[model samples]
Target: MILVVLGTHELPFDRLLKKIDKQILLGNINEEVLVQAGHTKYYSKNMQIFDFTTYEHMADLYRKANFIITHGGTGSITMGMKMGKKVIAVPRLIKYGEHNDDHQLEIVKQFQETGHILYWSEPMSLSEVLRLVKSFNPVKFESGNKKIISLIKQFIDGA
Candidate 1:
């Protein structure tokens, strides 16, 4: 199963949904597709979609999924990576009115550079990326917040 997760951004990420729906229509995606659409309103006969779901239910989906396609939200991507799932992150862009800024792109790029996930930047072909996903291996995501945590610990100790 393929899990598609569009995070709770205020605007809709209909573009990514449309592309996935189209790919399913063309038989490029043969696996069962599940989506957490969040605020995006997308209708697809090929996908089992929910506008919103409980965190526990979402966790079940994440566990059952073979791979994950998600927005560039760090939490979602990090969760998938930590689960050892191949994650493809598509950034919500301001030009598409999906976000107020392109900050998600920066996060996606950094994760991509670290080999923790795949990034679908603008002008990149979703089809090609989907093809690549068939054999993609994501590196394990190690927590980088230790430095911040250590500083906090030192501050508390000195206090």
Candidate 2:
């Protein structure tokens, strides 16, 4: 099963959803698709979708997912990576009215550069990504949040 997550952002990421839907319609995706649509209003016969989901439900889906398709949210990407799942990160771009800026693109790029995830920035065929996944070996994500924790400690100590 392929799990598609749009996160809980206010802006709707119908762009990514549409692409996935298209691929499913074209018979490129034969597996079952589960979507956490968030604010995106999309209807697809090829996918099982929910407007929102509980944390427990989300965690269950994560565990069951073979590969994850997600918006470029650090939390979602990190969670999927930490689970050792193959992740495809698609940034929510400003021009598409999916975000206020292209910051998601940068996040996607950084993750890709570090071998943390695969990123698809522009409109393209997901078939290529699907094929790549068979041979793709994603690097395990190592949390680098200790620096922030140290900064917080310094501030608390008035250092």
Candidate 3:
């Protein structure tokens, strides 16, 4: 199963959905696709689309997914990364009204540069990126909270 996540942003990320739908129509994607469509109101017979879902439900979907294709939201991208899942992130560009700014571009680029995820951007088709997923191995994600807590504990002990 392939999980597509569009975070809880008000803007419609129909652009990404359309691309995926095209792939399905072309038979490039033969697996089941589950989508967390958020505010993007799109109907696709090829996919199971949900307007919104609880955190627990989403987590379950993430676990069941073979890999994830997600918008360039930090939370969504990191969730897939932290789960050790291969992530293909597509940034929501301002020119398309998918986002208010191009910040998502930076976020996706950083993750891609760090070897945490692959990204779909201009001049690269999603199908091209999808073809790479079979061989992509994401770097494991380690939360910084543990290190922060350790530092605080050491400070208290010293004091």
What lDDT does each candidate get? 0.90, 0.89, 0.94
- Model 1, 3-51: lDDT tens digits are 9999898799989989898888888899999999999988888899888
**Candidate 2 per-residue lDDT over residues 48-142, each given as its tens digit:** 99988788889889999999999999889988999998999999999989999999899989998998788886765577877787788999877
Per-model TM-score versus the true fold: 0.91, 0.89, 0.94
> Where does candidate 1 have its weakest 10-residue lDDT segment?
135-144
Better of 1 and 3 by lDDT: 3
Candidate 3 Cα misplacement greater than 4 A, ranges: 156-159
Candidate 3, residues 59-145, lDDT tens digits: the string is 999999999999999999998998999999999999999999999999999999999999998779888898999899998998999
How much does candidate 3 score in TM-score?
Answer: 0.94
In terms of lDDT, the best-performing candidate is 3
Model 2: worst 10 consecutive residues (lDDT sum)? 121-130
Judged by whole-model lDDT over C-alpha atoms, candidate 1 comes out at 0.90
